[model samples]
Target: MAIGITAVAVPLANADVTTKANPEGIDVSSYQGSINWSSVKSAGISFAWIKATEGTTYHDSRFNANYTNAYNAGVIRGAYHFARPGNSSGSAQATYFASHGGGWSKDGKTLPGAVDLEAGCAGLSQSSMRNWILAFYNTYKSKTGRDVVIYTTRSWWSSCTGGWTGMGAKSPMWVAHWGVSSPSIPAGFPTWTAWQFSSTGRVSGISGNVDRDHFNGSAARLLALANNT
Candidate 1:
């Protein structure tokens, strides 16, 4: 139902996205330990995607604290996962997000939510792997009534998610591809909603490098992801 094209400035790239400009967000991982919340607040980071869980049993010690800090500072916030360990573990991680970050306002909008799946954790058959990923996706959908964006590499996007739209056709996508000025998204894939183009980004609060994200829609669309709208 949402449509348009915008070139989000990512320290790189101009892909085919629907909306005004690419929205800017950050994916914070353990790399951002001992953060200076004040510096992050001052850096004008419009949004943050924090690591919530790793496997079925491992959770980020900093997720709750980071979420609270971002919320307090009025930075739009969301959560993501390190997926692809296996299907069973994928389902477990999804459940983790549902219990922790899936709730929405009375109006039923949520902060943006995502699942970061890649090859190489414990590589299983593709079908089995997708089934496991779907288990989590289905749960998140049931809880939020909104699609959780899927983040994966260009290669994976081409081969993995090409045939699946089990979540919904209108759900947004977040693509991860490093290097080059910009990379075109694979054909058959819906337009991108977020582009994670760098793992070497330097932000004020972080000591080491951080992954930088760009939104493909307007400020309003991001608010929708945040469920603020």
Candidate 2:
């Protein structure tokens, strides 16, 4: 979800993607307002990641509500930061994310915090952006005790980070590739932990299109990842 804004038109989700995997989930933010998490869970959503903070200053206004409600509805929940690396230092952004809403706890259900690295890095030079991402990654890992997931499309990661392989050794990946048989992860990551396959997904509770995702492992393995075990 985009930071500090509401979505006007989110296309309907492709229902066909669910056939390829079990234990699928969704990612959402302030864009889909007032979601009925009960319906979402009932519709077979096993997990969720909510937008918590962006850059170093902005917080998702709907974070607490969605976070608490989603947990109460029995969805394994996680938090993510919509990164703006060009705007602020990654350490500050990590600290800001942890302070407001992006911290992850090992309750056996909360996945590691993620950095949303989409087009937010536009205009920044490749080397500076790489260093910026490292700063965020190290700080977030130190604070949360879990490696952050680098969420990006293959083209974007390749274009911005120059396909730096060091990032994948410690950081897990969340690759977004819409309408493909398999996610085209960049060269760095060994395997993707999560894949956001579609942005225009329709579920029970969300009024508009929500992002659909899939974990690469079984439900037990997913819990272990969340527990950081």
lDDT of 1 by residue, 103-212 (tens): 44422113547788775535566576557767777777777665677777667744665545553354467778788666556444567777888989888977988888
Clashes of each: 5, 2
Top candidate, metric lDDT: 2
Task: Indicate the TM-score of model 1.
Answer: 0.79
Residue 34, candidate 2: how far off, in angstroms? 0.5
C-alpha TM-score for every candidate: 0.79, 0.89
Q: Looking at candidate 2, what is the lDDT of residue 47?
A: 85
Model 2 segments more than 4 A misplaced: 1-21
What's the alpha carbon RMSD for model 2?
8.8
- The window of 10 residues in a row where model 1 has the poorest summed lDDT is 7-16
Model 2 TM-score on a 0 to 1 scale: 0.89
